[model samples]
Target: MSTGGKVQWINPHMMRAQNFTIRFVKPSRHMPGIVALREIRKYQKSTVTLIQKFPFQRLVKEIAQNLKEEFRFQSSAVDAL
Candidate 1:
């Protein structure tokens, strides 16, 4: 099930696959793939420059934008206005 905002709650019983209609239980705290990727973007530093390749710059910028959006960070000097 999805809370449909910044959060989601996976049904743990679904993992077992033993019961299709198991009684509904509290949602698990674990995050899904998108959330994990967003979190990585939010906190991790860029290692792309160290790659020493022409393709890496684009990758770095893309990653930076992802990080910025995840944390709602301002991206430009004009953001102050």
Candidate 2:
């Protein structure tokens, strides 16, 4: 079920279940250029980057405002109940 453009609850009994599987591959350091590619991937993952097009502070403020409105609505709903 959904509320306020978000999923509030899910009925597991009514949903289809599937088996989860995971595969692991062993890395071979003896492979040519594999080590360098792995190092580049590691560096890319470790580095933190921010978008320059939008103001981060404004985004945070908007999120805070949305949360505040949601909280107020929930509080009023509980009071009614």
Candidate 3:
């Protein structure tokens, strides 16, 4: 043990100072359409319309609605795509 508690001791101040990690993960194949859906949600008539109009619209619509209502969002169907 070289002093810094453990292999994964997260110091909030240090982590903030270091800035967010720059992840290189590739966007899903439907990313562009997903973005488009975000721009269109304000005008969607129904969940069905959202699903029919965008790539992953069902998930995106649910997430957006949850975010609007709860101020937080997370995906449950992680393996669906």
Candidate 4:
């Protein structure tokens, strides 16, 4: 299953020049961490959006956890996404 995320421009001026969204095409069960991290790295260049679509629930949680752990997020900041 493909997870989905919105990649938004961190710079307001650059928003018009680039695509702001990306579909998570990597398989969740087999290599979720790798895919999530890779996507996060890609999005860090921009800004990663939260996944609210029903189909991506599991993948969202996995990615959220990875973000939380990796960034040492202590509150609902990351998970609240």
Q: Each model's TM-score, in the order given?
A: 0.20, 0.24, 0.18, 0.20
Using TM-score as the yardstick, the better of models 1 and 3 is 1
Q: lDDT tens string, model 1, 4-77?
A: 34444446578457655535345455556878897689667764433544355555556768768543323352
Candidate 4 weakest ten by summed lDDT: 1-10
For TM-score, candidate 2 versus 4, the one ahead is 2
Candidates' C-alpha lDDT: 0.53, 0.50, 0.53, 0.55
Off by over 4 Å in 1: 1-52, 69-81
Model 3 gets an lDDT of 0.53
Q: How far is 69's C-alpha from truth in model 3 (Å)? A: 4.8
With candidate 4 superimposed using the best TM-score fit, by how many Å does residue 32's alpha carbon deviate from the native? 3.2
Distance from true location, Cα of 43 in model 3, Å: 32
Model 3: residues with Cα > 4 Å off, grouped in runs: 1-55, 69-81
For 1-81, candidate 4 gives per-residue lDDT tens digits of 244543332554454467554333433354558878987788788745555545455566577787685534333554565
Candidate 1 TM-score, true structure as reference = 0.20
lDDT of model 3 at position 42: 56
Q: What is the C-alpha RMSD of each candidate to the true structure, in Å?
A: 15.5, 22.3, 20.0, 20.9
Off by over 4 Å in 4: 1-30, 47-81
Model 2 lDDT per residue over 35-76, tens place? 799988987888454343236544554776777854232434
Tens-digit lDDT string for candidate 3 (8-80): 4455666567895533333234446786887687567544432443456465668878768654424544324
